[model samples]
Target chain A: MREFVPPSTRFVDLPDGFAMHRGGTLHGARIAYETLGRLNAARDNVILILTGLSADAHSASHADDPSPGWWEAMLGPGKPIDTNSWYVVCINSLGSCKGSTGPASVNPRTGERYRLDFPSLCIEDIADAAASTVHALGFERLACVIGTSMGGMSALSLLARHPGIARTHINVSGAVHALPFSIAFRSLQREAIRRDPHWNRGHYDAESYPRHGMLTARKLGMITYRSPREWEDRFGRARTERGLRTTDEPFAPDFEVESFLESHAHRFLRGFDPNSYLYLSYCMDQFDLGESCGSTTGEALSRMDLEKALVIGVETDILFPLRQQHDIAAGLSSGGTDVQFLPVDSPQGHDAFLSDPDRFGPPISKFLSVG
Target chain B: MREFVPPSTRFVDLPDGFAMHRGGTLHGARIAYETLGRLNAARDNVILILTGLSADAHSASHADDPSPGWWEAMLGPGKPIDTNSWYVVCINSLGSCKGSTGPASVNPRTGERYRLDFPSLCIEDIADAAASTVHALGFERLACVIGTSMGGMSALSLLARHPGIARTHINVSGAVHALPFSIAFRSLQREAIRRDPHWNRGHYDAESYPRHGMLTARKLGMITYRSPREWEDRFGRARTERGLRTTDEPFAPDFEVESFLESHAHRFLRGFDPNSYLYLSYCMDQFDLGESCGSTTGEALSRMDLEKALVIGVETDILFPLRQQHDIAAGLSSGGTDVQFLPVDSPQGHDAFLSDPDRFGPPISKFLSVG
Candidate 1:
């Protein structure tokens, strides 16, 4: 085991405009990343951590900014993705609002924000940017590449399209492509944001943001991200009686679940940009590792020459059902690749990957420990 | 069996202000209905068909208007709820905008559209208005009461709170109370409509309705109303080679599913009122048959005294899962009522009760024939 060290944030600039999958180009493309621990003298212990739709590069608390990262529970000394043994790097995806070259980023030619001017993005575009960041950091290969949800799809793309970037793969609650169910939900979210007159075709002023549309989109996302069981357990028909009944005040948040969504929506409205949200969510919908690789999702996974792979799925996940993870594992197994699939029983649903680190920590730590 | 006769549209005034469950009142409230076949001399052969949210009194074609209703697949001559035998009365519910006194109706006091000033509504209130319609029509008792989706909740309320209104009950994909999952979805839908600045707090002019917000809400609904399997089979990842791709035009409907939603949304916007939508959707979220019956869901259901019941649930319904229908059956059984719960295996999901009418017709027709 190696000693833990606080991660450092770094930015890598893609000097040339990055070409998008759908015949668009992103100029002055850059990715922000944070790395924990030190790379071994052999440079063989690097782990790339890809983020979901809204996460940044901050995977854990660092020395300068000791505030906990989103994945604070599972990335530290003696923790899964252990800083003690592996040099872990988490990169903010290309089209996100968080410290990345996105719609909010200024265009090189024009002095204004890219806004809708930013080229249309796809999951592979994000994966390509991550690959560039890894190469820029001077790493020949990685010990493993791990991702959850959108990040999981990105990792799959990296494994399928750009092989040998990582030795091992861990996909948590990720799909090979967007299922119709997810596509429908995401389509509605995008519609909600764009329909807001304030969105002004993604050209709204920063001060008077399209918060209402963003808030509604986030609420829809919050509903889909978690399982029905979780909501029932957490806030089943529970209401706060402090205010007049919701019957009288129909517009107010009545149920505890509504309040939960409202709180999350408010937080997201403050943190996320409307244009970046539309772009990234659309990218997620367009992601098809199978299409990127060759023919089918299974065929794509079968083509990956990984040392070992681990796939984690939750039972109650409606967004990315367990069958999707099973498909990935089966595809890899059929191709004679070493793979371990765990269908974890979790009521947390698609969000279990983030909320239930206990179920993930052991399997991840064990996989990293071997070889 | 009686000979089939086309129905006539009729409206009944409540005379005094109709009182709501939550203490709000709708003055000069009237219900619009269409009745088919002849009412037997005993006036006991009536099968009250409660319309779901967004549906009107037009459950079938009549002499005045030969156009098919929303449920055109069923409810014709020799069909389930057959005009050949049963005197079917389909009524537009109290809070709906279809010829009924609703938010769009002119207020007697202010001589303007009721809009938000319309009293807050609930399932029981809808049930109460339904009961009033039954009495006003001079039906000593109903042969059966049938409802689907939101109408299903109203039917449940009628059975549990206003007993003796019907001899038999058919509840399809309805719950005794709003689940947290559904409550969360409805909250987002309401937020989408209200947050639309064009909505102007439900005070928007009739010419320029909040169609965008309503469209988004309906799209969200369209996704939930059908199962993932149906979408995969119907639309898959199919994209048309129309104009430029979705990546080029982010705001446009590129996919077949999006197009389907857009087309349906446009139709709904043309026919429905935004304020009525808010009032009715909120009413659904507030529905709890148990509370109206002075107990828990199970307790309230157990308190019902019915001759018989047929509860239909689709295996793939995420909106109102089979478990909810099973609970309804179990509760009715606990009360010593003759209840037959049919878990119809269909890819249509929640809408299976409407879309898969062949399966429903057999069970429903058989039940009605026996009763």
Candidate 2:
């Protein structure tokens, strides 16, 4: 939601091991994360970030290496998140592979790769792990739990499941409830992954896994994640290799968009786990915050004891249009919550959370400063 | 592009044979066309219609015991074109079925099936054939020639190839120039046809040609022919046999849009000629008027001697946008031709030409209103 520019960060061993939805519990879960700015004497300036699908908790900084974190530019020092003043936590999600327990991790029971043996996980379990990580750091309540896209869902879920644990909550580019169209797009992505020949029904050796499936899934996901207008502006029938393709045509890519997809998917395959991808994606699908709570969105908001809520939306986000944000805002406002709804105008589409920092950074800074 | 509700019409056969592009060759080519309303004296009320890739000259009326024409509703009596007064002749282009020489026709060369020996008909070649059909009917000139999508290209080509043919021209949802993206779309469609086991590299047995290719082409074409917004509107995450698709689910068409694609493709296989589709698509890809005429659109229109022209466009027609129509109009106007441009708003995309007659029909009637 709010872009976090980090100041400084730290890594720690979760004293209370990370727990998951799967029956098999894990031991010694470590979080590779960052802390921005100076922690207040009360240790109450903490904000946690949940990453989107295929992203690790490395939301703000590079800990062990010079390789900058995914959103490091948006979160570090003088950046949006302003780690310079507030303590921020961005751990590698429990089921992620950024030095986290996942399919590639050793299964304590079998002494082998978990692979498909990993039990299906839901968003509630992810929230629990994140809460555990937060508690292990000696924090009683979070000043705010902010997330974007999938992370946004996690942020709201964190608040919903823990109830009053977060003084304030922020969500961007997602809904309190997952819509059918959004879930449908996610379904196609996972299907593309599982249908790959090398997927081995999720039992393949972690080394020789179904990379093509992941790539296709990413390509398809990319289409839904962005807009045709973006493609028109970025590519616009520009010829590259004496023709039009940029990647290894046929097998790789032809158009500039195709090439971008290839590189993006490859980057993901490097640090992400395919099985964990399924796990996280499933968790998102299971996230229906309003289902049991209430019937209408407004009714759902009334059910929550919302204190301070910041809902950020992007204008050109076709994946989840601004209407959803406005709807959430209307519901919260009707329920008398001090909600700050910031809708950033950006043609970057759904990916504007990363691309257009100038618009999102200011509102997020204002929201964080208000407290 | 005007849609017309039809009235009772007579099928007319021109006395002079239609000519192929192979120079002065009017070899027993009968012009099979349907004419509505009475031809005014000086033959000034005549509006000639040209066929697209697989379409015949039957733009409105059906021959006895015949098939319903493509633009019937929009061309009928009191409809947009109002056949009650305006004389309309839908001339079946030369290289098509439904009464024209095509792959199935017997060639004078060795008196056998033209098949592959039909000399790879180009867009200009078809334009010449259409010119012959109109001239054979004894109309020294036409009030206008309006075509949709592929037919639009043919109308433009006719003006450029057969100078002094029409007083006004309407090119709807078409490109003055075929971008590589245009060819890229065609390439994929042709690839599906070629890959069909039955196609056998364009030499399949006449009886059981590849219907699978036809289906595949249709499936892919369906995506480009409509807006994703329309698809979302029609089918939002409704499930059929599959359970509600979530983020973790497989890639199947639970939404109505996915089903629409399948059904559209399936219907295409039921009523279409695979070979004709291949040739027609290729014609569209090769439709670079400047390349075909060895000059620019302005130079070509300069030769047409047009008095008035209306370049119609569709807003959601991704295949060709309003900018393209503007380009055509600019070219024609620059050549000293009177030009009027009207953009029709329709969510049906390129198919708006056939789907939304209200947009195309009345405007055409007003343009062709003869005292």
Candidate 3:
């Protein structure tokens, strides 16, 4: 019910009466972000980092916040995305509970949480917000725009909607549009959240939150994010010493993998707002870059005027399969963009970008280091 | 919480105090089954069919039942199993709700529904009950034992535990043991059912069934049952006209895939007993063919004494991937049993045996016809 914003998070106010892609307008809406490294005199060294669902603006620890970030391994002084050379600006997604104006945020006009009353969100709106943040920072163009997971979708939207916003792009486990399988997984997650009686049509307060529903939704999300191969190697029929048991429940988390999911779900429960989660998830499902431009996905990709691009996909990603990354690469290649499509055989599935930085970092670092 | 048995279903009672694999016993317990053809005078010309978690004994329609059964396409007189030549007996899994003495059944000792009191069920227990059913029907051995999905695990158990129970075996989308991925999936499903407030620790009755939990569990099952490739071809990003909406919920089933899962989940909700479902799903996760015989999976598989075996796997099956089938075939082959590993490139995934009969039928028919 409450947003979990990092201490270092800063804000960029959108223009008054900012219109949403699917309709309605926001007054005094702002995007949350955090900056690392210093901008050059010309501002051409700026690297705009867009994030996936469930991430905040704190991509890494900086002077303002010493806490380790979600991408601490991949974004540091000498990491893949070397902060020393580039002025990195990571933006929290618009419809996220993490320091962003989402369903959890107070509606300025009504002075209440937006909840279900929040406007229908789209990937384009998220893209527009990120663009606005970049412009507000006085950067006409970014040296590179990096997007991972849902951020990949937003990155595509950013490039397609606002051509030349970035000189180069890096799409990590992203997609042009959600496949039916991905949609099915996300739809089930939303259903899990909504089906809880405590959800009370999005009216539950802090004490009466839909804990069970959110727990189930997060558990399902964990399953999809990681791959079977990684689990087989990591948890393979291993029993958990501390059983996830309640009274009279015979079927509890006996397996190590189930325990892993339970622990992760527990960590996620307090950090996110259920309503905000639903809105962002629905936005991802609705995102179709081709639909935004009224053209085929290939045509839409060909429209992006980037000087260079990098599309990285994990072979084991079930949510955004490797073929989707191939499609993006193929489309961008057709556009005469210097595109590098790196297919990583990481066993971590869709979450490889976050977990298997060794495989992900080199390609990103090499791509960013070039030109 | 009621069992939905076909009118033509028959029961074969086990001896007093039937022992379970994991410990505990079932007194006055019976196995539910239905036959498709006459038992030949030799009785050696019989095929025993074991089913997945939700299936009953009614594999096909009979004169008494009239209604079509689950495998209506492959089990009639002239169908793939060829009832004219093979007297086929399809046994409902021991822990299922369809006319079997399961969690939903009345406990003979207490004269009350067993519910969670149903002893720790295992694949070996299902196999033992199935073996007892075959023996009580006056057959020392079968022509072949066909196991599909969970039944495939049961079949492997049947063959391993009761060596020479069948002359030949067909393992369809089965595994020696569940992979961690499959366990995670089944664990979440059980969690979904148990988390339902109405579940009441498996005491939920007709009026207070855990509808939401069961719906979510069934929807997740449907997602894993079929392949992503099939959904891509069938649904893509297609929207549903009749949105699966409830009052005040914006994130309803919007995509065709979501609707498809929703419809399937709804149909299954009324048909299955949630307690029985949880018990059976747990049984699958606990099943390890090696654990039963106190050896490695390969070693245990080699212990099965059979003249021939055919392991059929679908390329797209995420639940029981193709490699598991190869492992089964290799193990059986190592035992000097004539084994054929046929990997079908079917897009229907784990449920291909039930849905994509075109790819599944020919191999089964050919395997049955030979010798």
Candidate 4:
């Protein structure tokens, strides 16, 4: 299992056309992925890593590019999913602004950026694209499928669409269905983008991006990702010395928390495409595997043919609360799947899956290693 | 104490110039207020009603307008601050857009809207204005000062500034100091306004207001004002019929919670001035009674010369958490003030002061009537 690390990135084209779950064909669709370790002779030791809304395919360092990846804490040699044993493939999601065929990608039909012309995406479409990528990699089934946040929803959708495609599923801080509070926030974030006059129907030049709207949306997302307790612990009512205003300046953020959000949101806006962010946010909110599988999570989970499942929830996650993880575990357990429900007690909230990987790693590693 | 109801809208010109806590003047300023019940010849039964960020001079129905006011449930004949027994005067705060002299008011110096040029406001400024209005009405001291949310902050500010102005204080869902989380959200909300192109440095025509930006800010405020439990009870994962999308449509809110926020936020935008909102929100975040006293609520309350006080907090309020109210009560109690802490079991969150007045009224009424 401890074979040579592959190149940092590899592209797999679904050439003839990749059929999207939402009734559209992604012609010349390509999935950009990075692999860790090596596939065994039987090609049955593969685990697919689906990332959160804002993450790319770089889950771990590779031979070609040795810089640490987004999930470097979890996916290194002898780590969780252990690059020493399991061959892990992390794909940039279908509708993301990464190397994937997303809104920023050029449409084959026209020599222009797809933008809104990219078929309306859903969680199922992301799952379908990942599944096709896995298939195209010569794997009949994955040893496990691990996803976080939006990736978790797509993972469930993957399970529902193609039974027995994955031997196990690791869902972290995700829901079977998006909650009302989250939907409301997501709707507002999308509106922020649409309302930006510079968006110009999503056809603005890449240089003159919708920074304000995207920054607002990112700040909103950042707020939801962290808990109130975390904010309090991190930044108390500590105000700046010079204050947000000088003698003649207008009002600005004087609090440290505002500074934190501004820094992170600015970083996010620089990297993300506004239209892709909108599409993916909608995809996450609109995803409901239950709707496709007889109207309930229990009904849908009953159809899931996974051998084992791991559901991890953070106590302080307001976006995807512990209740959602409980539902996932209960549904799988009722369906006779060996489901290990691990509630990570952390103040990090939803982002704990990424930030506090030490707590998440052991449980996830143990879950993935069982047969 | 039962006497005839007074007029609804009374404009008191603070023509000499109202001094701001931050060291500026509102010249030719006016205080718009409404009074209920008769001010006894002694003027001893008068009670002052301070409002949250958005409320007006009208806290309840009066002779000039028969329509039920925002707090009509808690201020009627048999209600908490019973109009039959107490002469109630609710003044629009100094920096509010409601009928008060705010950023929306015309500046006497230049004969233009004050906008950003309005004197930088703080909680004490509002308290001073309210106190001046009381003095103008010929009341040496108020029987009680009952305030909620931002009003509660103003009440505390009033106590800190002029110790014996009110005999009793009732604070509902308010804090002596704004927490970091609330400050962060408020910062983003203001940014939403500033970043909106239509805001045009706060000089946009009233008709072409920053609708989208204000809507975004309002939605953000609405989310924090309620709890996850309330949202679950209200909207769950209920999707609208015809779905969130029809054939060929752009993004729109498909969730009931989104609809709820949209309806209320739209109504809020129509009546509110953007500059006033920015000013008031900053005023709230900058309110720290501790800074004026001695670096703690305990120090501030120790100097408060009130006879009795009641502090009420809703269990689910994220904006002004129960811990804050607990701190206020503890601080006052420690300082030898007769403080009664009432913890309300409510799912309405910070807005419980307005929505769950049934629970709020009894304790408040009982406390106000004591002695």
Query: Which candidate should be chosen as best, given TM-score against the real structure?
Result: 3
Candidate 4 scores a chain A TM-score of 0.95
- Across B1-371, the per-residue lDDT of candidate 2 in tens digits comes to 01111233333443344444433443444445677667988887777776555556567653442456787777767877777777888765555555655555555646765555555556776677677668767888888787777777888888888888888876777776555434444555665566455766556665767765675567657666765455556654454565445544433345455455557777656455565566567666556777678886667767778888888888877667678898888888898988889888877777777776777877777777742
Q: Measured by TM-score, how close is model 4 to the native structure?
A: 0.95
Candidate 1, residues A1-371, lDDT tens digits: the string is 11112245678986586788778777777888888877889999999999889888888886655879889888887788788778989989898877778888888889888889888788888889988888988997888999989999999898787777888899999888877888878888887788777888777876767777888888888887999999888988898657434554566677888888888888777677788889899888777887886588777887777888999999998888899899888888886679999999988988887887788888888988888
State how far residue B62 of model 4 sits from its true place (Å): 2.2
Which runs in model 1 stand beyond 4 Å of their true positions?
A1-8, A15-17, A24-28, A244-249, B1-7, B243-248
Interface RMSD of each: 1.4, 6.2, 0.8, 1.2
User: What fraction of the native alpha-carbon contacts across the interface, defined at 8 angstroms, is recovered by model 2?
Assistant: 0.09
DockQ of each: 0.65, 0.14, 0.88, 0.70
* Clashing pairs for predicted structure model 1, backbone only: none
Candidate 1, A254: how far from true, in Å?
1.1
What TM-score, to 2 decimals, does candidate 3 have? Answer: 0.98
Q: What TM-score would you report for chain A in candidate 3?
A: 0.98
By lDDT, who's the top model here?
A: 3
Per-candidate local distance difference test: 0.82, 0.66, 0.90, 0.84
Model 4 residue B187 lDDT score: 87
lDDT of candidate 1 over B1-371, digit per residue (tens): 11111245588887576788888787888988998777877877899988678888888786677888767777878777788877988988887888778888889989988888887778888888888989888886788999899999989988777777788889888888888998888777777777766788777886667777788778787777898889888887777559225555665556777777778888777577888888899888878777777788777776666889999899999888899999999998888779999999999988887787787888888989894
lDDT of 3 by residue, A1-371 (tens): 55599998999998888899989898888999998888888889999988989899999998889999989988889988888899999999998888778888889999998888889899999999999989988999889999999999999999999998888999999999999999988988888888888888888898999998899899999989999999999999888887666646678778899889888999999899998889999999999989898998888898788998999999999999999999999999998898999999999999888888899888889998989
Give the per-residue lDDT digits (tens) of candidate 4, residues A107-180. 98998889888887888888888888998888999999998998899889888888899988899998888888
